[model samples]
Target chain A: MKINLKVWRQKNNKAKGELKDYKVDHVSPDMSFLEMFDVLNEDLITKGDDPIAFDHDCREGICGSCSMHINGRPHGPLAGVTTCQLHMRSFKDGDTIVVEPWRAGAFPVNKDLSVDRSAFDRIIAAGGFISVNTGNAQDANNLPIGKEAADEAFMSAACIGCGACVAACKNASAMLFVSAKVSQLSLLPQGQPEAKMRVMAMVNQMDAEGFGSCTNTGACSAECPKGIDLSNIARMNREFFSANLTGK
Target chain B: MNWISTFLKSSIGKKLLMGLTGLFLCTFLIVHLSGNLQLLKHDGGLAFNTYAVFMTTNPLIKFVSYGLYAIILFHAFWGLYLVMENKKARPVQYASYNGNANSNWSSRWMGVLGTIILAFLILHMWNFWAQYKFGTTPYTQYERNLATGKVTFSPFTGEIAGKMEKFVDTERNVEITQVKDLYAIVADGFKAWWLVIIYVISMAALSFHLVHGFSSAFQTLGVNHKKYNALIKNIGVWLFGIIIPILFAIMPIYFLLLN
Candidate 1:
């Protein structure tokens, strides 16, 4: 398929950016969206032009590194998928694709397509973990975990820390991301020691990162590559409220 | 002053304000539509004009009417102010926004939707309120009469005379008043299918605007948590999207149904 692209380009965090257009031809139907970009990059590099820069370590969708908004949508127009996994077949023969950097005040554009998601990392580090002391490997049977709790915990833990939720949200709120992490840990006994503290620190970190408050637009779950439910958000709210009041 | 501050401060505070104001506006819309519905009622010219007079002259309602004006302005300005700052507050989004982007498309376009709704509001006020306030209204039933037994008609003058009938309520029979030619005005302007069509489209625009505004308002006010957020969002979509549209749509449909 023939394609036209309008992509956002910038040098670094402080640079002003604008959309630059490009044309690509002979895109194979089977090419993964990232592979087509690889073809585009090769052409740019061979011609002595700076290649389009985007973040992608793993071509598989799990890494959440293929950070590019195609046609005003994150990860292109497809749902429940990542950019790395998107195929050229989804687009038309001669479509004009408007590729943009992820927009939200917190996630600044690092270059073309690649954004500085260190804010997410900072929020995670703020309280995403359960603190435990060194000890011998404990028996798995020691903690009496119920099936429902274990399943819920696993689901929450499935979040890949991608900022897709924030990008999709009208308010650019990280509540879904922050809450999912909190719910994942708080559901289990191992996380009990730091449960309240984790939610408090993480939510504060989220706010400190200058993300907007959640407006429940539900855009986060819609854009989530992992299908993380907004239920995780509700649980996070419960956790945060309890944490603030109980001081436990 | 304190009430405005109450709205801005806490999440609960904001939620309460959004909910109270939203529900209040909803009430006003229904009442406004009901009075307009009189055009299709059996009383002919008398029904609509009488309803219009009652709305304007009733002292209690007139006082409450002032609050209604304030609500529209407050909701409009505050929503814009928040969206503008929010745009600045989060400059960049995550690279891949999301495939699911959720159910509330209108909420995302609140700014644009609000603008359209505002334009409609101005048109709305010009049609009914301005005339009730500044322009002439029938002081007595006899003022609206046939010139002779042969039956008289006032020549439809301009858009000025067509204002009341431009967009009308569908639910009840409204008194379409005397104009340059009163019969020609109601039967021609409103009873004509084309003008009714225009009014229907405008109501639809209002509907889409409310779809997003309703849920977004609750979220803004802090209708948070796992248990209640879904309820709040669902109610928002239904009330704004479904209920309001139906109410507004009913007015045009009822009028068109009229002989």
Candidate 2:
């Protein structure tokens, strides 16, 4: 299959970027989207041209490293899958795939389709964790958690820190991402001690990072590669409200 | 007080403001629509005009009306400010953004729909509220027989007076009341096809706005529970979005076609 690609290219974070067209022939339908990009990059390298650069680690979906806005969606047309998991067969032969990096003031483009997502790191650093001193791994049954709470917490914990929600939101809001992080901890008994502070600090950091406010559009969860629910945001709102109300 | 200011300044706090103001506005819509439905009564503007008089003159309602006005302005301006900040968050936009793929069009285009509603609000207030308060809204004299309870109305071309005047005539067993005829103005305003068209279009925009806004307000206020979400979404999509807007639209269309 021959695939037409309009890939964004930039020299560096400060450089202006534009969509440069490239055509890759002899592409297999089973090749992953990133693998197809690798083919295109090999051709570009063979022709002594600069290859397009993007982020991808652990070609599997869990790493959340592959960040590409394929045809306006975070992970191409398919839901609940990262770009690395998106196969070429999702498109027809001669399909013009428009790939761009996450466009947010918080996530500045580094080079081509790769972006600097350290804003997420800064937010997480603010308070996205429990501060218990670790000695050794505890027995799983030592902490008694309800099945529902455990399931919900695990669901929230599935967030891989991908900036897909930010990329998908029209406002570029990080609420879903922040909320998922908040919920992952707040729902667990281990995360109960610093729950209020965690929510307040993380939310403040998210605001300071220049991300927009959530409008409850559900776009983030809809385009989320991990299917992170919007309910996490509502839970965060509840936590923030309760935390502030309690003045704790 | 300091904590209050801090909360209001935060992003979630700003969203809370939007949610509070939006839900308040939604409440006002229900009240406003319920009152406006009096215009459709067969009483020849008597019921609607009296209701309008009570709405404007009653001290408690008047106070609430003032708050309503302030809330509307705050909601509109704050929403626009948030939208500006949202735009600034994405200084560079996607070259090919298909927002429809993930979100509803109403959710994506809320600012635009809200702007349209604001413009319509200005026109509506000018046509009705301002006209009733300052401009020349003609009055009507209503005479009701005390025995038969039958009422009759005629345009009062007499001297300018207060909002309402009432007197009972013992000889004819009739009660005469003269009041400012706001309903007449409303009905007459809707007679213009262009105005009715504007109204219908504005109501359509209102419907789309409320469809997303009602449920969105709940989500922002931390009300998204599995138990109540279906109810909230239904009220958002049905009551505020479809029923209220359609009912409001029917008023202008009714006046234009039937009245």
Candidate 3:
């Protein structure tokens, strides 16, 4: 199959970017989206053209590094999956795919289709974990958590920090990303000690990062590759309200 | 003192303010719609005129009216601020854009819907609320007996034969209810087809605004419960979005055609 690509190109973070056109031929229907791009990159390199730049790791969708806004969606056309997981078959022959980076003040363009997501890292560092004493690992059965609570915690923990939620949001809000981390720890007993401080600090950092507020459009969860529930955001709100009310 | 500034400055806090003011407005919509719906009553506007007078003159409601005005202004300005900030967040535009795949049309275009509703509100207030509050209105008085609960009014009688002060009901006794002819104002306004059309279109815009804004406010405030979240979302879509707007639309139509 033949595909026409309109991809964003920039020299670096300081440079202005524009959509540059390219054509790729003889693509396999079974090729992953990134693999299809790899073929195009190979063609560009051989022709002595500056190769396009994008971020990817583990091309299997787990790394959360393959960030691209394809056809105005984060992670391509498919829902509940990452761009790396999106296959070429999702597009038809002669389709002109538009590719761009995650556009947000918080996530500045590092190059073509790659933005600095270290904002997420700083938010996590603010208060994303428990500060329990270091010791040998405990048995999985030692905690004896209820099934429902354990399952919810595990589900919240599924977020891979992809920043797709921010990219997909009209407001470019990072509430989904922050909520996932806040929900994951707040649901478990081990995550209880620092629950109050965790929400306050994380939310403060998220605000400091200049990310937009969550309007509960559900687009973040709908586009989330791991299907991270929007309930996590609600949980974060509950945590923040109580913490501030009690002066925690 | 520090917490107040932090809450005001923080993104979530700003959203919380939006939610609180939004819910307050939702409550106002229900009450306002209920009062307005009384225009359809066939009692020669007696019931509606009475209710309108009560709403306008009650001391408590008057105080609450001031708060209501403040909240409406706050909600509008705060929402504008958020929209401007979101626009600044994305400096570049997509070459080819299609957002319908992941989100609903109303969710994506809330800012537009809100602006339309705001425009409609200004026109509506100028036509109805401002006229009611400050404009000269036609008024009439009825005669009543304090002891017998008997009331009397006549289109023929220009003035009462007896002193109206003697019939005053200080403690649950019968008395005349002096009210503005607001019913006539509304009934007269609906006679215009263009005004009716504009009202119907505005109600439609309001419906779309409530569709996303209702549940979104709750979510912004973190009022989520596992079991009740779905129910809250459904109410936001169905009750506030569809039912209330339809009920409001019925008023002008009823006045124009039936009344």
Candidate 4:
């Protein structure tokens, strides 16, 4: 198959970037989207041209690192899948695919399609943790978490910190991402000690990092490579409200 | 009010504000809608006007009414600040970004719909509040005692309206109702097609704002657990998307169609 790629290129965060078009032939329909890009990179190296740079660590959709606004969506026109997991079969021969970095105030381009997602890291560092002492794991009977509570905790824990949620948000909000982190940690006994302060601190860090407020568009879930639900956001709200109301 | 406190600028802080204010506004909608419901009655209903005047005149009621204004200003301004910051941070714009309008119109047009609602609010006050506060209603000659030559006003004829039910309800734990000529003002204002058209647009804008506002409010407040998040959105659709339009549409529809 032959395909046209318009890729975003930037030398660094401070540099101005634009889309440069490249044409590829002999692309396999069965190839992963990233693999097709690998073919392009090979051609770039052979021709002494700088290859397109995008983020992808674990190609398995769990890591949100393969974050990009592919063809106007968080992950290329496909729903509920990440860029790395996408296949060339979704498109036809001679198709023109546009690729760009996640465009948000909190996320800036680091190279080509790779944006600095350290803002999310900063938010996590600001709070997203349990204050439990490091040791052999506590006895499971120390805390009898109900099945419902345990399930909810696991569900919230599913957030991959991928910038896909932010890319997917209409307001460029990190709320779904932040809320998931808060909800997951806040639900468990290990996270109970500093739950209030943790939620507050992480949320403060998220805002300070310049992420927009979540306006509940739920695009984050739809575009999510992992099907993280929007309910984590609501739980975060309940948690945050309780935190503010009573240290009692 | 620590200027740089994490609570004030924190993401959760912002969400709390959004949630608290969103909840307040939601309550206000019920009140406003209920008042409008009275418009379904004949002569566009005196029950609505009697309540408006009672609210503005009563001391405690007036205090709460002022609080409602403050909430509106805070929500609008804070939202603007966040939106402007987001604009500065974004790098690329899509050729066609309508990928997510399916969720809610309010979510999509936060700024535009909010502005429309604000404009409608200003016009509403100017047309109704100003008249009730300062303008003189014509004192009417009523059915009177012929022998005594004294006036006896008729309630149904719009000569002398009774107090709103809420004000007089023993179950209500308040001193006064804001109801007054505001109800009459509301009725007379909607009687004008142009004014009714503006009112309808504003209601539509409110619905749009609400659709997104309701959902966004939850997200901001950190309501992102998978089990309950969809519930909030579903409720948002029913509340903002369906109910609000019904309430707003009913008034204009009644005036235009029935009147």
All candidates: TM-score of chain A: 0.97, 0.98, 0.98, 0.95
| DockQ for the candidates, in order | 0.24, 0.87, 0.67, 0.44
Which tens-of-lDDT digit does each residue in B1-259 have in candidate 3? Answer: 7887786777778889989999999999999988877887665565677787678778899999999989988898888888998777667766665678888889888878888888888899898888887875555555566787466643323443321213466676667655566777888889998989989999998999998899989888777777887898899989999999999998888878954
Which scores higher on DockQ, 2 or 3? 2
TM-score computed on alpha carbons, candidate 4:
0.82
lDDT of 2 by residue, A104-187 (tens): 999999899999999999999999988867799888899899999999999999999888999999999999999999999999
The list of candidate 4 runs beyond 4 A from truth reads A130-148, A244-248, B1-5, B43-53, B91-98, B101-103, B141-192, B215-236, B257-259
| lDDT per residue as tens, model 4, A178-197 | 87888787778778889988
Pitting candidate 2 against candidate 3, the one with the higher lDDT is: 2
lDDT of 1 by residue, A1-248 (tens): 99888878887878877778889998998898888889999999999999989989878888878877787677878888888888999999889888887787888788877888999999889988877668897888998999999998998887887788877777777888887888888999989888888887887787778777665667888888988877776666556656655764
Model 3 segments beyond 4 Å from truth?
Answer: B140-178
lDDT score of residue B251 within candidate 3: 83
What TM-score against the true fold does each predicted structure earn?
0.69, 0.98, 0.92, 0.82
Tell me the alpha-carbon RMSD of every candidate. 8.3, 1.1, 3.5, 6.2
Candidates in descending TM-score order: 2, 3, 4, 1
Q: Residues B115-186, candidate 2, lDDT per residue (tens digit)?
A: 999999999899999999999888999998999989999999887557988899999999988999998888
lDDT per residue as tens, model 1, B1-259: 5534532443323334555586678778768767666665544455565456566668898899999999988877766666775676566543334333465565566578777777778865675566556655433221222332122223333444332442222443322243322322344345657656766777777787766666555444334556776786576567667776777666656667764
Give candidate 1 misplaced runs (Cα > 4 Å).
A1-7, A16-31, A35-51, A88-98, A130-146, A169-171, A185-204, A212-217, A234-248, B1-20, B27-40, B44-67, B89-105, B133-136, B141-199, B215-259
**TM-score for candidate 1, residues paired by index:** 0.69
Candidate 1 chain A: 10-residue stretch with minimal lDDT: A239-248
Which should have the higher TM-score, number 3 or number 4?
A: 3
Chain A TM-score (model 3): 0.98
Give the winner by lDDT: 1 or 2: 2
